[model samples]
Target chain A: MKKNDIIVIVLVAFLALGIGGYYFATRTESKNAKVVIEVNGQLYKEVNLYEDQKVEIETSNNHKNVLEIKDGYASMVEADCSDQICVHQRAIHYNGETIVCLPHLIMVTVQSDEEYSVDSVAN
Target chain B: MSSKKTATFGVLVALAFIFSYVESTIPFNFAVPGMKLGFANIIVLVTLYLLGSKEAFVISMIRIILVGFTFGNLNTMMYSLAGGLLSFAVMALAKRFDGFSIWGVSVLGAIFHNVGQVAVAMLVLQTSALIGYLPFLLVFGIISGVVIGIVGAELTKRLRVILKV
Candidate 1:
């Protein structure tokens, strides 16, 4: 690679590392984490992580996703979408972590109750 | 296009198409969603350096549409189109500006490809949390981009003499 190429690579590498570092550093593990499920950008359900339950979501498009919350973690155990990408994503327990199913327009995000209260105050 | 140019474009497009098929079967289970080796980009890069930006754009578009029809649905096609379009645009701009090598162009294309997909994902899901995926996708893009660029550079060199373009 040429000098300019090296510059581009270094710039992108630094940028990636910077954003990644910030994300990890700011990650907070809440004592009362809640799993928020959204379908087509609307709140479908919110469940406590300690509840240990299985959530089955069926979108209007007839898409299906099975989310399982157990041991203080939330994960997509199964999905009927062709890619099954959400199923392959890692289980998340920390605030701001997400498992997204693009085909079904499903998003499973972990949010701490503190953020919920903050939203309430703002509202 | 002349008969020879038409034949060459056909061959290039076919090669890109096969790369897409091969990529789909590889089962890249990388934890992070939307992570792809982007093998088809190698052929697109080769086409860019060997032919021209216009030819490369057409070949890339044809490959995406053809692959979408063969192995994927409309949703998949839309994602691919976003990635392909953004990637090709960045690569073309990089090439036109000069200074950076093929590797740089490839890496930029790969990175922006992910960015484009993420943009669409954000709009579809209506959540900014998807930005969390950028770091992983960026790192993966760099790795895959370098590999594809290496192969593409070699192919472009050899094809130049073979095709005498």
Candidate 2:
């Protein structure tokens, strides 16, 4: 590899590592994790992770997302959206993890018992 | 372009379409939504090196459109167009630079491909939350890009000898 090739490779690698480290470092730990479901940014439902339940959420008109809470983890079991992004996302149990179905404007976030702190500086 | 060259591009476009269709048949998922091995890019790389940028752009666009119509929706077509255009532009530019091999060009092409897809995702999602996926996507893009680039460059080298171009 030439000098320029090395430079490009190293540059992308370093940038990815730096941002990845920052992401993991600032993650908020959820002591008592709860599954928060929002439709078009409005709170639709909240469920405790400890409980096992299958919730069928209808958000933004006819869009539906089926969320399953099992064994202290929340997963998007099914969805009627074209993207199926939320369904493809792995189960999220930790604090600050989210499964967002963009086409349906449905956001599933995991929140801890701690009070909400709006930190706008992360962007 | 001459009729002969046009026919050649048409054949390559068909080959590109086949590569895309073949990839879809494989049971592969990286756990990242919309992530693929991008094997279709091998055709893009080869077309760019042999026929030039404009032909490469045409081939890529036609391949995306054909594949999009076959197995994907309108949204998929939009993302494919955006990603294909940007990757082709970056690869064409990288090829113009001196001393950077086809491998390097392919790597750049793949990275920009991810960047382009992310840009479209941010626009479609209408929220910055998905921006959190950038770093992870970049890491994946780099590794996959390297593999695709090496394979693409080797194929290009072999084709050059076989085709007597």
Candidate 3:
């Protein structure tokens, strides 16, 4: 292989490794802490820090949803829709982690009302 | 172009569009919005190798727009468009470097696709907080892209005789 080709290969390899390292290192297991659920800038529900608990959410639009936070591992236990994306999410026990159900527009996060971080995504 | 070549291109676009539509129906539904199976990308990659960058790009864009219309989600069009364009651009650029096979190009494309979407999210939300999620998306993107790319490359190899383009 040419010298330039080797350089390109190394660069791509480094980039892949960097991305992989960043992903694993930043993963936080919030298996045993308070869990908060919010919707449209409103405090909707809060589960006392627990290893695992099934919390059901009833939306204004007449949607039934369940969030399970167990051992700091949080996930969507159940959902009203055919596609259960929330259940697939790993529990977030970090200060700024979130699980959002775009179809239902429901956002389950680990932050409190006092934590002012960001607003809704545009479009 | 000859009528035969035109016909082949038309057929390829149709196949890509169908693949894209079918893929949309497959519910990956991760809590992370925009995360998807992207199985239809196999067709795009195959087309890229068989027909070259220009044709592959056309096929990719056509599929994206067709799916966007079928889904009828005007709001999400921006995000999809941004991601698709970014992915294709990265793959095309990587095609220039030696030893960067189709799989490598696909992984790079996937990485850029996520980056584009996240960039859009950050701009739309007017906050950098969402940027933190980039690492997670990157890891998944690379893995999925590699898998899909392999399938696409294999498919292209099989079709080479039939598609003499």
Candidate 4:
């Protein structure tokens, strides 16, 4: 491989690994976290993680997402998106963890009170 | 452009549309929602080399619109448009650089394609949290990009001799 080829390969590898390491390393699990749901990028609902709750978020544009909080973990129990990827994703129960339904433009995140001050992403 | 050139562009566009449809029919998922083997890109890369970026851009635009209207939904169209445009731009720029071959340019195109879709996702969702998925997407992009790059490079090399552009 040429020097440029090597550089490009190494660059992509390092960028992915470095950012991935930082992302996962900084993610913390907090028992007292809150499940925050945002619809169309606006705050639609927020509830404590410990509460066993099923929040159905419906957007004005006919999209729907159901957020289920159980056993201190939050998951997208249901969504109207064609892919169903959000519904199939694993539960999120840690700080900075998010379950996103791209089609519905819905997001479900877990954050502790300390970390709840507008997630780094929200900013 | 000559009628012959127009015919070539039409054929390339048709090929790209067919490849994209075939790709969508593949059963297995890449684990990442927006990721794909991008067989359609091979045509785009080949067109870029055989014809020119202008013709390739036209082909890419038509492929997205035609395929989007027929087999896919508006959501699919939006993501494809956002991703295709960026991928086209990146590949066009990367192709101009001698240090990077078709392989590198194709890879860069793949990477930028993912970036563009993720950016749209972030905007649609209005949450940076979705950016969290970038790592997974990027890792996938690298593997797929390299594969696309190699295939694109080989295809471009072989086709150039036959087309004699």
- Ranking under TM-score, best-scoring first? 1, 4, 2, 3
Per-residue lDDT of candidate 1, residues B45-112 (tens digit): 99889888999999999998999999998889999999999999999999999887999999988998
> What DockQ class does candidate 3 belong to?
incorrect
lDDT of 1 by residue, A9-123 (tens): 8888998899999999999988888999988888999999889999999999887889999999999999997788899999999999999988888889998999678899999
Cα lDDT of model 1 overall?
Answer: 0.90
TM-score of each: 0.96, 0.86, 0.71, 0.88
Docking class of 1: high
As a whole number from 0 to 100, the lDDT of residue B30 in candidate 3 is: 57
Interface alpha-carbon RMSD, every candidate: 0.8, 2.5, 4.9, 1.9
Give the per-residue lDDT of model 3 (tens digit) for A1-123: 234433444565576578557755875543334577765446787776554578888878899888876766567778886446566766676756677664555677665433232233332
Cα shift from native, residue A15, model 1 (Å): 0.8
Tens-place lDDT digits, model 4, residues B12-59: 888999998898787645435676678898899888888889888999
Given candidate 4, what's the lDDT at residue A118? 53
In model 2, which regions exceed 4 Å deviation? A32-34, A38-44, A59-63, A80-85, A102-105, A112-123, B162-164
The 10 consecutive residues of candidate 3 chain A with the worst lDDT sum are A114-123
Q: Is 1 or 3 the stronger prediction by lDDT?
A: 1
For candidate 3, the per-residue lDDT at B163 reads 75
Write model 4 residue lDDT over A17-79, tens digit each, in one string: 888898888888776788888777789888999999898999879888888888898888888
Predicted candidate 4: what Cα RMSD to the true structure?
A: 3.8
List the lowest-lDDT window of 10 residues for candidate 2 chain B: B27-36
Q: Write the per-residue lDDT of candidate 2 for residues B13-115, one digit (tens) a residue.
A: 8999999989878766444555667889999999898878888888999999999999787777887888889989989999887656777777788878877
Q: What are the fnat scores of the candidates, in the order listed?
A: 0.84, 0.39, 0.13, 0.43
* Candidate with best lDDT: 1
